[model samples]
Target: MSLRTLAVVGTGLIGTSVALAARRQGVTVYLSDRDESAARTAEDLGAGRAAPPPEPVDLAVVAVPPSLVAPVLAESQARRLALSYTDVASVKSRTEREILATAPDPTRYVGSHPMAGREWSGPRAARAELFRERTWVLTPTRLTSKRAFDRTLDLIALCGAVPRVMGARAHDEAVALTSHAPHLVASLMAARLRDGSAEAAHLAGQGLRDVTRIARGDSRLWSDILESNAAAVAEILTRLQEDLTGVLAALHDLASPGPAVPGGTGPGGGGVVPVPGRHALVDLLDRGIAGVGGLDGAGGGRRGAPGRPEAPAFPVAGGR
Candidate 1:
């Protein structure tokens, strides 16, 4: 069935964007947020009306942070805000577990995470097109009703997002590797620039900018996300730490030369300093290239304007 009425439980970027996209699809949207000003901002921007739905809507998208998803969903369900419910929190496992324990009707709920966002947050940064061609993950449990799951797919369709279903734990682990850990790595690299010398800052180029771009995300929100997915993120970071240690050892070996290449090019062409662990450095670079190349067409799907629904290419089923 097509989604007709919708309630957005938060007016942040993801929530506002969902409201805007739904509105574009002719779905009535009611927007609400803890920050009244933010909800009004979304209303002023034509995302939706700034109020709770007078009666139950077709679907309610709970777009709160990871820690707040469970409580928000429970509260919304208590009010009977929508016939079905889904969330846009980045981490899914924790939220899913809590929802199962707290929600009045866990069968009416499906845990979801839209793989689309911007560094800038809130309604001001929201765009109707933010989810175009993006993957929206649905982590439905065995208890999830088919109606609830289908409404979420309708919501994703209305927002022009492709739906990919996975288990709650799998979704959390995947995002930890692809999104959460990468954001932390970027922030770590970006932080180094804070204490960098003026000369070093001046020499910074696109490579540094690209690596640090996501570091501009709201820290409070990111802290909540990282805390929710701590175990998965930690697992990835631990592997990264091991790699960093290996690289550091190789760098030290290269710096402490064991041999010298007799050449004619230093001052007036002297002997060249030998790089002892050049092979390790080259191997790392090659692996980096391969890893990046693997991303090309990793999630293939067709792009369309926001609100233009597309039929999913495959049958939708949640992972174990």
Candidate 2:
């Protein structure tokens, strides 16, 4: 069914943002959360009424914890609370399987993820603009109804998010590499600073912030994310480790300039080449720039989506 009355199933940041966005679109929104207080708080923020769906709803958004989304969807479907169900859970494959095992008909069930969020947890940190212009993915199976899928896409557009179409396998694989692996890296790096001296932490600057911004996310929630996507995460991590080993070996060779070929040695053996002096270093830098340019085709502008047309850019001189 098309979206008219929407029931938001958890009043945390994502749910609250959804309510705010949906209301702005002139749709009726009903907010709910197991912690009824959170639902009330979201209502106070003008998200919606702190009540569950009474009559049938056009859309049900399960924005609860990753692990709880399946059970919630199953129950909602059983009780016929909504004509179509979707979730904002980060991981999808596991969630899809659980929903199938627990509730047979996912013809109306769709999986979704908005590639945007803050480290802060509840409604207080919610931003109506959080998902704006950000990529939002929907992993609809063959069983998913076209109406439900299209309405979900409409909801994504309503929230000012960019819509991406992907199957469950592709979606999981892509995020596992881009999102999940980076999070694990952030947490591992942040853990090193947990017990550092106050002086050391104060010495920390934007570089550390850039690296660990995501580490401050809810630990329990991330634990669920990592656990659910363990297989894909492990595969990505293995490739990362191999790259790290190669870099470390290169560093060792640099430190001890022996009879070694000098660049780096390996199977294909791009080999330990020569240590270039100043001019050579500059030449290598240019080569590196070219390499990166090749990876990023055309404008080399990564600030926008790949293959998407960007508005004309006006040149600005440095602060003169």
Candidate 3:
């Protein structure tokens, strides 16, 4: 089958990036976005033509917010805009459920999440290489057609993303701890700076920058993401809270200098006679800070670095 065109129903960062990538591969694209100006902008950038379906396309990519994925797919399928559909929503379970509950036949659709993004957003932030080398998840139910699956996977490969297959629930659960929870934690921490002292804000460095990067994402989009994976995110947050409490308790002991602070004991000499949890927490945090500094293949404390005395070579993941 000679596939010629793709219908991109959203023109935000991911959508525009998809258009740019597909067009670069010599595929024709049809563009649509609620924001007319944004849609026009993407077209002007040579992403695609700002036109509705001149004829039913092979695949439709609904690259809207997490909340709109299902509804948009249902409406698009209902109107017969594309023979098959897929989405680029970050969270997958709720959207998949919504698709099953709404679409006439969910078989014509696939739920996908690309594990890639940037702190910046919108069409201007769109880059054809956005998904390069990233893992793109495809959650296809038993009802999904082979044609749809093949077509969607083709698009994923064309985008330079490696396809990882998993159930929708598994996808959502994994991203909850790895992506969603981290975003919430970052936002909550950045919230502290809403009224923080100027000196503190100015002195902020990569530590705060890395943590708060996702905090700058579209709040409305994240609200939808957090809600969809609330159960899993809640579980992760509970564990994180437990860790945070440990860190705080440790700080309290040292700040007030319970009783000379040695021997891993607290004020009442009841801290932790052996294997102190507080001291362990401090050591873990120190290790984490040091490990992060070793990012970019650069090592610190060449003599006594926490992670490994000797650097593990550059780009451990890709052998860069």
Candidate 4:
């Protein structure tokens, strides 16, 4: 099924970006948010009109927080707000569970997460091309109707994001590793700067800036996200803690004086030898390099995919 009209709930960064992208593709869009001013801002930016559609829309895109997804979807479905519904929340398993329990028509809903965003938030930060070449995951259960799922695929195509399908639980666990846990790690590292002296602050370089860039995200939003996916994030943090302990042990060895060399003969005779666990530090650094290189090619930059089509044109209404 093709998407002609879309109703976007929550006119924040992701929501407004979806509306703007859809509108740019000639799909009529309606915008709404708890913050009326935000909706107005998105509307002013050519995303969509800040009003509910006169009739049921082809699809309703819920772009609210993970915890609010089920309630918002239930309300939208009850009002017949759209012929089909989908959400752009980060955690899918929890949202899907709530939808099955609370929504009037769970079959009409599919859970999705668009793996794209900027450090900034709100409509002002929204961009029509924010999702181009990005991975947008769709987590559809057996209960999801074919018609609803197809409509969501069309919406993802319009947004120029490559669609990847995964089970709800898998999606949650994947994001916990790639995003949720890393966010907390960044925040923890950035927090250390809070007590730095003037000289230390002045000596800060790009490495510190790069590592903590994501720490600038809205704290309340991140807190909610972390709480929703607590189990998965906790598991990743546990593994990270193990690695950190090893690294700390290696650092302690490096800081302590090593045993003197047996052959006491040259100038300053027995200079302290290299630390015994130096290999551990080198191995850790090597693993970090490999991990970063792996992420660089993670997408493989494939073409002709759902959201990465070559020669993409404006989607024709009622046409695939």
**Of 2 and 3, the candidate ranking higher by lDDT:** 3
Q: List residue ranges in candidate 1 displaced over 4 A.
A: 257-259, 262-275, 300-320
Taking the tens digit of each residue's C-alpha lDDT, what string does model 2 give over 1-320?
Answer: 24788999999989999889888888889998899899999999988888767797888899987789888888888888788889998888888888877774689888999888888999888887778887788998768898778878878988988878788778888778777898998988999997899899779999999899988898888889888888999998997677566556656655675554445444565543456343344455675476434433222122356666663553322212
Q: How high is the lDDT of residue 137 in model 2?
A: 89
Off by over 4 Å in 2: 195-199, 248-320
Q: What TM-score would each prediction reach against the true structure? A: 0.89, 0.79, 0.83, 0.87
- How large is the C-alpha RMSD of every model relative to the true structure? 5.5, 8.0, 6.9, 7.4
Residue-wise lDDT of candidate 4 within 186-267, one digit each (tens)?
Answer: 9999999988999999999999998999999988778888999999999999988988899899989867886554544676
Error of 1 at 238 (Å): 0.6
- What tens digits encode model 1's per-residue C-alpha lDDT throughout 16-135? 999999999899999999999999999999998998788899999999999999999888988899999999999989888898888999999998888899999999999998888889
- Model 3 has an lDDT value of 0.82
Model 4: how far residue 169 lies from native, Å:
1.2
Best prediction by TM-score: 1
Q: Per-residue lDDT for 1-320 in model 3, tens only?
A: 24568999999999999999999999999999989999999999999999997788989999998888988888898788888889999888888878888887798898888888877878888999888867889999768898888889989888988888999988888788668988998999999888889888789999889778889988887798888789999998998788787788776765763455355534665444443455667676886676456454532113233555555555432233
